[model samples]
Target: MKIGFIGLGVMGARMVKRFLEAGHEVFVFNRTPEKAEFLVKLGALRAKDIPSLAEQSDVVCSCLSMPEDSIKVFLDGVIPHAKSGTICLDFSTVGVDTSRIIYQKAREKGIDYLDTPVSGGPEGVENGTLTIMVGGEKEAYERVRSLLNSLGEKIEYLGGTGSGSIAKLINQYLVAVHSIAASEAMVAGAAFGLDSEQLYKLLKLSYGQSRMLERHMEQYVLDRNFEPGGAVKYVHKDVKLANQLFEQAGLTETLGKLAENSFSQAMSIGLSDLDMSAVIKPLEDKSGVVVKK
Candidate 1:
């Protein structure tokens, strides 16, 4: 397939690599241009602009950073310029309304749009093991199922447009909540003079264990590696969007709001660039205890 890709951020850049590795003819573009250099070195063509990419490709894939970026790229760029019957796969995690609006707009143009939000971080991207949540027309999804297989091992097709983003936001909501809870438990243990390592080990085999607990404690928190896998600011945006989703669904926004605030607090104090596990930092500061081995 001839693939046009945009947004060359940490995960996006790597996903383009996957496309290239799978023997696809790839066109790469990023706002910065320089971010496409590595892929360019590996035989991917550079798109001078979004219109050029849209004009040249059979499939237009995007993995943008923000909801606004996704909208402007598709609404102003791809949807207007791309030919009919193009399949646009979006791996960004914008909310339901954003996805559905774009999906409808693309459908009107005869371009099939799939809101294909993904999880599993950079590791997932590189290893092609990401859990992909796909939402759009079932026929459209089937057409690109083979292409998607090159990027993700676990591809789940949800019902319709926006379903994927809805599911992704819900996943992120718990990711935020569980991150905080895990951090608190570890910190609380440390504050009371328990061994952080031993406590984490205990939690691993107990009912209190969670994937977030294992991820933070083993990979990030214990190693004191605050470098982002998924950053605080992104999680804040996701949980905030998730909170809005619940509110729109007529549920009271309680835990979601609190998680959003917690991540916001991480953002306000210059921890936004750190890993989501750094949500623990504020609590650590308050308790004067670190959750390191």
Candidate 2:
């Protein structure tokens, strides 16, 4: 299949490589021309701009950073140039309202738009094991199932339009809360003089275990390797979006708000570029104990 991909950031670049390795013809564009150039050398075609890429693709897939960016790309770059019947999939974590607005605009132009937010971070992208939550027309979803399968281990088609965004927000809410809880638990355990590695093993087998504990704590936090798997800044955006959903739904407060504040503090202290596990640093600073092996 001829696929046009926009946004070549951490996850986007890896996904484009997956498509290329699977023998699909890929056309790629990025704000940074150098990122697109790197993909071009790996057998993907370099698109001068989004419109040109949309014009030539059977399926247009975008993994942008912000909802505003997704809006601009579809409204200004895609809808104008993409042929009728082109399927557009947005894999960004965006608000439900934003996804629905874009969906309506795409429908007006006869383009099928799916808010297909993904989980599993960059590791998932590299391993072809992402969990893709899709929301759009059933027929349109079936059309891209094979391609989605190539990129993920789990692909679920929710109801319509913004359903996928809602699902992804819920997923990210849990991720944020769990990541914060995991950090707190690990930091507390370390402060109490327990071996970090031993405590992690016990937590894994206990009721307190969570995926965040495994990914954020076991893999990165305990080792003190705060390299970016999913950065704090991006997770901050996602949690804030989740908080917006809570506010719109008339909820007084959510645990996501707490995670948002924690991530915000991490960012204020200059930890935005580090891994989401770096949220532990502020706690470490306050307690004077390192949650390391």
Candidate 3:
């Protein structure tokens, strides 16, 4: 399938590569031309803008920074330019209401839209092991299943137009809370004079094992490599979305709020560029227990 992709961030850049490797004709657009140039070097046709991208491809996939950005690209930029029946698949993690609105507008334009938020971070995208939760038309889901296989190992059609966003919100909540727990547990171990590496290995082997603990906490805390696999700012956005969803659903998730605050605190302390696991810094500051070498 000929595809037009937008947003060439860490995850987006890697994903565009997978499509090219699979022998698909790919056109790409990014707010910055430099990011799109890497893919252009690898045989991707660069679209000058969103409208140009929409004109050039049969299906368009977007993995933008936020829900609002996704809306602007599609509604403001691509909707008028897109050929009727062009598939607009959103891989950004955004709110359900936004997804619903976009889905409706896409349908009215005779376009197919899918809210397909993904999980497993940059590692997963590079490895094609990401988990995808999709929400859109059933027919569209079936039609795009094979294309999605290029990006994820596990894919599920959650329900209607916004179900994927809802599912992703739940995923963000668990990830946020578990990530905070991982940081706190590490700090507690360090305070008690337990080696961070030993505690990480032991906990990963025990009931406290989690995807976040294994992939994020272990690397940032043990290896002291704060390079972002998923940046603190991105996770902070996800947590904020989770908090909004929790409140809208009439449930107060205290732990979710606490996790949001912790990540926000991490961002405030100039850790936004670091990996999400850098939340350990705030914990260290609060308790006066160092986590790094």
Candidate 4:
């Protein structure tokens, strides 16, 4: 498949590489050229911009940051120059409303569009084990399934238009809550002088285990490195979206509210660029008990 990939951030960079490794001819672009340059060296042609990318590809995939970024890239760049019948897949975790709007707009232009957000982060991308939840026309999804298989271990057709976004929102909600809950648990352990390492191993063997718990245990409990698996700013956006979704549904989520507040507070303390596990920082400040070394 001749594919155009836009947005070469952490996840995007790895995803493009996976496609290339799968023997796809990949044309790549990024808002920051340096990131894409490395992939360019690996045989990805550099697009002058998204329009050029769209003009020369059968399929286009994006893994941008926010809703606004996705809109800007597709609207200002790809949509204008996309050939009729090109399939555009967005792997960005964006809002359901925005996904519907993009789907409608893409169809109007004779392009096939899919909201195909992913979970499992950079490690997942590298391992080709990311779980992809796709929402689009069933025909479009079937057409792109092979290409998607190159990048994901598990791919599910999640329905139409905004359905993938809805699924992604729910996924992010749990990610935020679990990560913060893990932080609180670690803080509790510290207060009781329980060995943090021992407790992590015990929890992993117990029902308290989760992907976020294992991921955080790497830096927070073990090495104390706060780099981005999922960044602080990104989780802040997801939590805010979850709150909006809850309000729109006329529902209340007190626990979700607390998780949002915890991540929001972490962002407030200038930890926005750090890993999502840095949510532990605010709780650390409040309790005066840091989680291990």
| Every candidate's lDDT | 0.93, 0.92, 0.89, 0.88
Q: Model 4, 188: alpha-carbon shift in Å?
A: 1.3
Location of the lowest summed lDDT over 10 successive residues in candidate 3:
215-224
| Candidate 2 lDDT, 1-293, residue by residue in tens | 89999999999999999999999999999988988877898999998899999999999999998899999999999989999999999999999988998889999999999999999888799899999999989999999999999899999999989999999998898999999999999888888999988999999999999999999776788678999988999899999999888888898577888999999999999999999999999998888899887
Ranking by lDDT: 1, 2, 3, 4
lDDT, candidate 1, residue 171?
Answer: 96
Best by TM-score: 1
Give one digit per residue, the lDDT tens place, for model 1 in 10-75: 999999999989999999999998899989999999999999999999999998878999999999
Per-candidate TM-score against the hidden true structure = 0.98, 0.97, 0.96, 0.97
Quote the lDDT for 136 in model 1.
Answer: 92
Predict model 4's lDDT versus the native.
0.88
Candidate 3 root-mean-square deviation in Å:
1.3
Kindly report which residue stretches of model 4 are placed more than 4 angstroms away from their true locations once superposed.
Answer: none
| Candidate 1 ranges beyond 4 A from true positions | none
lDDT of 3 by residue, 1-293 (tens): 88999999998999999999999999898888898877988999988788988987789999988888988988998778899878989999998888988888888899999999999888899899999999999899998899999999999998989899999989988989999998898899889998877788899899999988887655677777888888889889998998998898898856999999999999998999898888888898888887654
Candidate 2: list runs displaced more than 4 Å: none
Best by lDDT: 1
Worst 10 residues of 4 by lDDT: 218-227
**Could you tally the backbone clashes for each prediction?**
0, 0, 0, 0
Clashing pairs for model 3 are: none
Clashing pairs in 1: none
- 1-293 per-residue lDDT for model 4 (tens digits): 78999989899999999998989999998878889778988988998888889999999999989999888888888888999999999999999888988888889999998999999888799988999999999999999999989888999998989888988898898899898899999888877888888888899999999988888986555677887778988998997797788788887855779888888888888999999998888887777887764
